[model samples]
Target: MEFLELPKRTSGNRTYGLTSIIDLGTPTEDLKNILNDYHHIIDTAKIGFGSACVTPNLKKKIDLYKEYHIKPYCGGTLFEKCYYQKKIPEYLTSLRDLGIECIEISNGTLNIPMQERLNIISQIKKDFHVIAEVGSKDSNQEMPISEWKDEMKLLLEAGCDYVITEGRDSGTAGIYEKDGNIRSNLISELIKDIDSKKIIFEAPTPKHQMYFIKEIGANVNLGNVKLTDVLVLEAQRRGLRSETFYLEDRECKLPL
Candidate 1:
């Protein structure tokens, strides 16, 4: 069965080649079905935009994700909401009660001072694994490349387990222009200065995913992938799809 050769991919739980899927009100049954088929390839599942706060079967979903060894966490907006409302202790307790061990800390919508953000990350690291997201959600609020690099470094140094580049669920903000075009120069600068493996780029669209796969190789860490696109993304990573088919050597002959 091991007939075709392809570049090696890190194991699912490993730090590299991570794929973080988004759970935006996916029904429990639908989510279970997806996990039943593709759990092995998914690294994390983010409960999108405070959905976990309102989803009736949040605990059930969290338990299912844990059973499959997938880290489940609330979206950053939920964390921001709790923080601004001065309910962080309650938020952490709720997460614990829900059997969630991971959380995202981001200031994409609310502008928390950088030092304060780092302090929050440090505090959160004590009880939960933190995935610190950098970049603004506002399409017009472009940040200088230096600031991006610095913030990423600071988050990592502040004890964040991973750093996520801001690509809103729509894939039209943060690293992408309003038209969904990537800021290639900014990304290039970040890659040049930071460890690509330590950062996850949110690529919600096929075009964005293809660009990252081709530009950063098949093992790039990607996030915000839709549940339906999980298998498709895996195909692209293995060069089974047209966009990456050239990654394999066509000239090689298989044994008859």
Candidate 2:
């Protein structure tokens, strides 16, 4: 029997409807299994935190991802470590050697100067696709909405391919509150001034993903998703899951 079709979504290469899953050092064999089953839904794979630094057979794993047409890149924390340790050049070289064409530049853990961050984006944009993240990972540090908008604009102008809204792995830091609830007002204000298509919201949890799909439309760019949740999130996006099944109703209209 034929399955019900999903709402139209952009192609995997398109700027919108992208889902970036985190590769938190899964074993190469398991990663291959995941890619084999869900590569079509996975647009990008982020080697989370500093796991890329310690994962064995790193090059082989990266190669596997590339073979499956999944864009893989190191997480922003790795960039912060390299930047603070004065190893930016070396880091870039090593990434290239490992066949990583995309890179995430974030100042979540490091207090990188704005000018320096822009400079780094500019430099890296020449050799790699840049995903610049805006926001502090520390829950205690709250940035004004105006500042968040300004930073996102600066990062885009500085040549970042896409700007990421910082939501840590737990979905409790950055754009989210300590309890993992999204700061809806702040996000609304930020998106009002910026293009939603250019922003990848890090929604690690099912609830967060469902919320974005309902609030921002089906094609919202979401990131920091766990490897196993890739297909599940796609199901929600397609109104295949109970939480979002109402989307399939002909008379239902989404909130503006």
Candidate 3:
């Protein structure tokens, strides 16, 4: 069935316009069913928060995501937990044994200094694809725009494949206001000098998704998405959804 033209999107192992879903303990059978239907559009699946440490059949889930070429990784909070517990080596070994290929290193909750964090990223980069997150999970703690850009630059230079802004799965912190609204000025300022392609904005709501698709174009990398929202998000990205019905034309602006 040939369809009408829609917004162009990179497909099959996409580098841009990535949709990273948060898998917070969906059963293996259920995950298989969902992946069977929507895996092609899912670039990565994050086991939300510290849930990966206790999820039964963890390796099976990781293997399934890998089978579809979707990068599977535990959330950064889990890494913080491991680091605090002085089990960083054990954590990495367990994840490697589980067939995981990518890792997210973040200081969202911990106070790991920039130099130490960089050193950690340097070490981790040798074994896996590293994605560093920059921002505090605390809403009251506002990082200056310059600091955000500076840290992101340093992380990318340290060999992180991408840098993620800390918008928690709830969508009520980090890049967002407490009420779940985006800080448009902050986004504008941060992207003024930094590359949006190297950052994955944690957009977990329909509004967030539409805003990014309209403002940053269809190729914007979005994370912390719910499993149920996958198809609709993809539709929105393609301008098939009414919120972004005109995105095919608007997306030409690119990498703002």
Candidate 4:
């Protein structure tokens, strides 16, 4: 079968349909070089794992990413830890000073109640384009698929720009099995009535990315992706790689 035609999203300076890269402490200069080389290919850049708090030159780094037209967001875990320690308002203020226009709101590490989570979503969007996460960091802590669906419905309705499923940085927690594979039964359930376009699946591992593509197709929204993999990830998204090569090869086997 020939490849399916996927709709193209607006590139650069886009509000939605974005492909983001997680910069998990890539050295400042190297990050600049990557952005200089591939800025057109990256829609968003994240200073990963709260590494920002100690990165020393965050303001300069943010300035560089901004120069390349990449919007940077704070890593959610850092935000949550500060919030739990009663420093959320301070954290937001600091992020603003650093020129962050996007903020990720997630309770992946801290156990924030529903009402409070929704409030955080509402409050953040009032000042920034909020990206909310819907799962937990602990692998043993499983939320019913129903809860995830409800959260997605509410987060988008609550004025969040996107709802990211908490696939964690490893992609082996939450909905994924220990082998880093997506549990189809669970995924199907979560997306039953949800819009895939508004979701950002945390498929950090390549196998998880492959599974999502093979099972859900190219348009699935992915997040927490490593910076070095941005080109390859986009290649996989555009079906320019061998993962789609066999599908290309199959044309020769078909009857004319």
Best by TM-score: 3
lDDT of 4 by residue, 46-108 (tens): 787678888868898898888988888888888888887899889988988998998888888
Question: Each candidate: how many clashes?
Answer: 0, 0, 0, 0
RMSD in Å for model 4: 4.9
Whose TM-score is higher: candidate 2's or candidate 4's?
A: 2
- Pairs clashing in candidate 4? none
**Error at 67, model 3, angstroms:** 1.2
Comparison by TM-score, 1 against 3, better one: 3
**Candidate 1 lDDT over residue span 121-150, tens digit each:** 777788888899999999999999999999
Q: Against the true structure, candidate 2 has what lDDT?
A: 0.88
For model 3, residues 217-247, the per-residue Cα lDDT tens digits are: 8888999999999999988988888888887
Decoy 1 TM-score against native = 0.95
TM-score of each: 0.95, 0.94, 0.97, 0.88
Give the range of the ten consecutive residues with the poorest summed lDDT in model 2. Answer: 247-256
Cα-based lDDT for every prediction: 0.87, 0.88, 0.89, 0.76
Residue-wise C-alpha lDDT for candidate 2, range 160-194, written one tens digit per residue: 88999999999988899998889999988977888
Error of 3 at 230 (Å): 0.5
